[model samples]
Target: MIQKSFCAIFLFVLGLGPISLTAQSLEIDADLRARFEYRHGFNNLFPDNADPAAFVNQRSRLNFNYTTEKLQLFIAVQDVSIWGDTRQILAVDGNDSFSLFEAWGQIQMNENWYMKLGRQVLTYDDERIFGGLDWAMQGRFHDAALLKYRKDGFMMDLGGAYSQETDRNDGNDFRIQGFFTYKALQYAYLKKSWEKSSASFLFLNTGFQDFDVNDVADGVSYRHTTGTYFKFPIKIINVTGSLYYQFGKANATTDLAAYQMSLEATYKKNKVLYGLGLELLSGTDQDGAAKNNSFFPLYGTNHKFNGFMDYFYVGNHANTVGLNDFYAKMVFTTGEKSTVLVKGHYFTANAALTGDADAYLGTEMDLVYTQALMKNVNLNVGYSHMFASESMSLIKGGRPHDNTNNWGWIQLIINPNIFKADLGTPSN
Candidate 1:
């Protein structure tokens, strides 16, 4: 019934299209993106003599916005597909890779308060713990209702969501049995900004539902993750810091306890910028069947951190052992419209090591350049190389290290506004 209610509300807003046309209060938004990616040793620890794979991924979106003085109705739909995955000339479900990206309505209660409900995306802070993950071909979104408050640079948001197995056919298992991300999520974000400094905080909780094998019943588990980020400028150098902790009962019925901390400094002189940073995450010593000490970023844009190679803490290695990343970077402006970035990362495990395992892991270097083409088009190319030590190989599954681990990719992004209709102001 709840799902049906939400669907009805969404459809009702969509049905307002005719009214919007008559009132001249409709706005249309569209985005078309196609990127070609080539992967080779991008994940490291490749098989023996592996070949590179290249593919083109595309994402297209259509959005409708009807705005009034007191309320706003927004709906966004998208189609994502891989090149040549389906027939181009035929129209079938195989070629119908479409989904509702965002559907929401906002009620502006006053000048400083507003409430938004329905399926939407939550993006906050430096995208550390909460981000939209726009780097991926499909991107990321959430089904949540958000309450927002803003006055000047100070902002606060409190959002929450709950999920259940709504498959009516399975009448028996239709309710919440766990508290995982697929089950429930709640969070609060707060931020304040000054002239040259800013601070933000996040409190996130996820509940997982699981079925009890012995009791033949279902239950939910909850975990809590919280963090704070702060940044300030001192003379010519800028500094940023973050601290996070994770606790509560894990989905697997293990006691959760972990923490992460980071600090970074950047200096800019004319067209050149220099950066240095260090990050550490606590880990569980997996010597035996011990409790979990590893922390998870949960719903974060992990691709932006550690390194672009996505070697550490992004996938597969989650909740395994903690990680420590020490890195440096340099950015140079080629001209008025182009820039080049070069970075190096040194990685190691944070947990205690066993026999034959050392702390010295490996090093990675990344080089990227971006140049603007047209007003709405740009070109981006990047390459990275990873040099692994013997200890690194052991920690990273001990794969083949005879060949130089390398990855290269180039991307072109074109953004053009397709349509526009403004009722308030008409242009000549």
Candidate 2:
């Protein structure tokens, strides 16, 4: 019923056509991605008593978009299925459900003002520090409304949203956020000379309960995050840096404060690209007694982080164990239709330890080949290897230990420009 109401409202608005008949536009686009993987030693990362077959899973995503002069909308639906004898582990019941990833509308009031409301993504500057966190099998979203103003190189935004625990519940948890951005400077480096430097600030306040009903009874929790990023070109290298600080209260008991920083340098020339990155995070333990000096990736895409195996910062676990990651990657194109990419990751634990203990250490390597099968169809094959350290394997109790694991994946991406209607078509 809610979905139907939303669609009806959307179509009604879309039916309004363009605000200005002289200057109107329409566009439709979509992206479809699928992944197949094979695993070895994958069970090493899970509990020892757990079945190895449970680690293998295949996934796919279908993303669609439609836009006009005054409004824009997008949706991404995902599906995951198990292959071979791993069927039971990947249950196909309620667990397999379609989701509304991004369903939003944009109202462009004028050249310098607009508003977007609904389930949408909010990404700013370099996603390295503040992003939509879109790397997971299912990305993240907030039921929110956003107002934006833009002119020249300056932009400002205000947003708010609510999430209810019950269908007919009266008390609905909510969140509010505000952001501002400005391009401080823009210049040329050498040769063609192209450069852009900008700064952004974001403030978010949220009050919500945990997934389990028993977690927070009455009190509301909140988290405050502030971040900034700077980017420019020096010689042939592009440099970027990011920093973030978060403080809040969760469960009405524990007080939380954390921060993270990252630095990156990239060099691109011709069809070759190479880059290096470093990231650090600081947080606290569940007891709020010991300080956990880990890495908080925020909304950045984790797959684009330290390693492809995605052991740390996968969620909040890295918040427990301190993490120090050094990453590097290179991409090169072949002919006009094929491309090759290579990435390497090195990770080590930075947690404050009492005794002489080996921190977790790991390395990952990825190789990818891409071929443009057609104008809107592309095929990619990828393989990744993860080598774990002693700290990742050893176990203290009878439970299975965290060990090194190896996994590989193959994917296909289809992006088609399905339709393009004149901006004034509706107005006419």
Per-prediction RMSD in angstroms?
Answer: 4.9, 7.1
lDDT of 1 at 424: 54
- lDDT for predicted candidate 1 compared with the true structure: 0.77
Residue-wise C-alpha lDDT for candidate 2, range 1-428, written one tens digit per residue: 33454355445544655444444444445555666766655323645544443233444454445565565666555554444533454434345444566777788888877878877776666565446765455665566677788766667777766554446646544222212111111111111113366656666554534333553335455555666667777877888887777676533555656777788899988999998988876634322353333335555565666666666555535446556778888999886999998988776665543344476566778788989998988787877777765565432222233443566666677778765665455434
Q: Candidate 1, 174: how far from true, in Å?
A: 7.9
> What is the C-alpha lDDT profile of model 1 across 54-162, one tens digit per residue?
8888877666777766678888777788888986665454755777788888887899999999978778777777778777766677888899999999999999987
Q: For model 1, how big is the CA root-mean-square deviation?
A: 4.9
CA lDDT, candidate 1, residue 111 = 96
True-structure lDDT of candidate 2: 0.59
Most accurate candidate by lDDT: 1
Cα-based TM-score, every candidate: 0.88, 0.76
Instruction: Supply the TM-score for candidate 2.
Output: 0.76
